[model samples]
Target: MKLTSLGIRQKAFAYSMTTLGSSLINSLFSFYYVKLFLNRYRISEGMFHQAQIVFMLWNAFNDPLFGYLQDNAKVPCCAKRHLSILYGAPFYAIAFLLPWFPWRDYQEGDWLCGVQLVIALCAYDGMLTFVLLAQCALFAEISTKHENRLQLIKYNQVASLVGSSSVLFCGLISDNMENIFNFQVFALCVAMLAFGCMYYTGMNCVSQYEHVEKLEKDKMEDASNLSWTSVFYLTKQIVTQKNFLLFIVMNFFQVFHLAFLNNFMLIFADHLIPPYLLPAFVKSIMYGAGFICPQLLILSSQSLLRKLGYYKIILSVFYAELLSATVMLVLGPSHHYVLSMFLVANMVMVSATFSLFNLPLADIIDADLLNYKRSFPLSSMVFGTNALFTKPAQSLAPMLVVTILNQFDYEKLKDNFTHSEQSALQDLHGAMFYLVCLTPICIAVLQILAWTPYSIRDSHTDVAKYIES
Candidate 1:
């Protein structure tokens, strides 16, 4: 039996604590960590992108092994899912901030480049792979009921909003890093304050029967410690499903669109805002919009999914992202009040897109269980695949922005162009439109195409067929 009202509340709090805790620290890393590494180390733009590509390749290498082990790996007393989170949490926390602080400074040439590469391996590859992949796979263990699983996602998302929106606290810390906080001192505080406390919080979840079943299946799969060869065999079996394979392809394209829009925003602020403070303020305004947008979007999602269907919702969100991109481009480095309207629209649309996109994952999961006569753990699939595609967008998007930046040679600014320096505004415009609108447009079409042939919904009628076979 599931927990009662108070019991569920308590468990929710515990899970929320872990979600909020890690998200809080990760949020700090996201907003300030890039500026810290870029400015403090004076790393070249071209090189940074290349490093990200290398990190993606590392994921390609490790995740099949991870997905396999996570699938077939078992725990003695506790659930394997919970065990994965607990054991990896410490390593995850450590590697997360590894890039935030370098052991020592490197010379800014051949030697420095080599050192940077090592740090990327130690920091980006290590932390992201462990924490994200583990936590995402950890979702499968949240609840066995389909609706309950989706509710768990809601709780996780709320924590995400809290964590991400509260990033200003860290921004202030970064500004004061030299004068008061210092480097390791600040890192220690956040690490202890966030991850340490959250680790304790995650321990409170009461195990359920589904968790027990997973453990038993894992034990049946392999009698000893998980080996690399075993994981590959499991993956080969899992991906043979046409529906699952198509979903993966669709996910890659749409998520690539998301990654593109997300990573390229820096270019907008860089090109548009003449005053540094103003740009940040503009960006910060969007955070507030992002904070509330998801909740509001979810209100209509159920009805929408019931009516026009999930696929249509996905396509609509894609168009919304595109509209957001187009509005920003027309507004361009010019600060008309109208621009803010476009921006708020952009935020709402992208925020809503995430909410809309979430409903289908569980639906697909259910479809998988109903059709395949076996369970596929999807937690790893979501985040692990995301990290895979993210490498290309993170590296390439910035490079695209930087190439535009190279247009500004201070000496010839007035003579070469019409009024003032070009400020790479056109590049920013092209990037935003391409990422949010154009890319998603293509992916959205592909997603529709990929899913059209698969009739898992219709297969719901085949319940007796699988049993009778």
Candidate 2:
């Protein structure tokens, strides 16, 4: 079963199609779901809160479970990473469409709406977990060389530029989400496009070394003999590792910051920027920039990524974010243009930084393999465990922001209408400013603290040495 040989560039492109597919659907869901359910559909805050609770609980269980299954299962599709994608992509696409359709017409406080939200979130998350766990596992399995992984990242960000444009495209077709039917039509098109990309990637991309590894019957037998006790021990070992602990702590805050911005950026733009000052089209472009510019920034930063390394680059981004947030806070929200620019820029930086997380994570996986003297990579388990800790931040971010906004009479602004009362607008604006600015300041400080002690020095050297052996 020799796989087709591909040059590095070809492999990178093929591999990155997974990113293109995943990001297309995921960015749409992450950025728009909160607004759609809470505002457009007019679901109550209490119901939204209940859905998040269910989502958080489900999110925690699924990541590690899927990771363990993918890594350990004897099923052919589960054993082969790309095959998993081929089988799972269609289901993932279907899940992406879940929230777009309401199962029933419902009045306010109807438990059916809450049920729909819960099912939408959990279904999408479950499928997403299965597909992406395979994609991420393929990332480590594809190559161990630092240079090779960076190539994959470069191609991925490029793909992300296209995939992430689903948001921009949706904005254009839906007239900034004012038309429900248009948005629904746009989503169906996106789901089809995403499935094609993922399916193509699965069929085309193959790990260069996997065929050789498959020849090792003894290792396969050993993997078959893996048991629950071994799984528990491995989980314990991973969780107890000091560097893994530090990384997840920092990542939790990073996820929280990203979730906050992605979920509510539109709401922020609608409320903070008056329509007369900045046209809806201009705001649409800005919203689109939040998705697109991050890739461009990361693409431009390749030299920095190579020279400074992940730790330094990440810390620099965090500190820069902290400083920028502080400055924005001091300046206040009086200037709508400045506020809008800051919000978009903040999302760009955060999104870009988040994109590079897999690099360090790959390093950690390499370190774990070495430390445990393991024959095979535990990439899925490591990523899944990390998600176990970080995914909750996704649910928590919306809940916290909504709770705070509710305190400031945010319910009254759900229609996204320009308020007539200047006094109420002023109060909501102040609250929004603090949420946008203060959150990063606090998160940056915490991330800096957590990340500073991370001791995975010289990932390139470590990974290169590991691969050569």
lDDT of each: 0.51, 0.87
| Residue pairs in clash, model 1 | 136-379, 137-379, 322-437
Q: lDDT tens string, model 1, 1-469?
A: 5545565556556666666767666655544544444445545555665665665566565564455455454553223555555666676666656655555664433346535554654465555555445555544445544344445555666766666554444434443233224555666666765666457554665334244566466555643654656555445545666766665666665545444444444333343334444555555555445444554565546455444555666555655655555555555535534554454455455545654444454445444455545534444544444344434444454445445444543123312223653455344444443443344445556666765665444321222221210
Compute the lDDT for candidate 2. Answer: 0.87
Compute the lDDT for candidate 1.
Answer: 0.51
Distance from true location, Cα of 358 in model 2, Å? 0.4
Candidate 2: tens digits of C-alpha lDDT, residues 1-469? 2222356678788889989999899989998999888876778899999999999999999999999887777786876788888999999999999998887876767788899999999999998999888888878877777777888899999999999888888888888778989999999989999999999888988654355655335446766888889889889999999999999999999999999999999998888888899887888888889999999999998887777788998999999999999999999888788998899999999999999999888888888988888777888899999999999999999999999998888888666446457787778878998988999999999999999999876775443635432
Candidate 1: residue 438 Cα off by (Å): 5.3
Q: Whose TM-score is greatest here?
A: 2
Over 4 Å off in model 2, which ranges?
Answer: 1-6, 213-219, 461-463
Which residue pairs of candidate 2 clash?
Answer: none
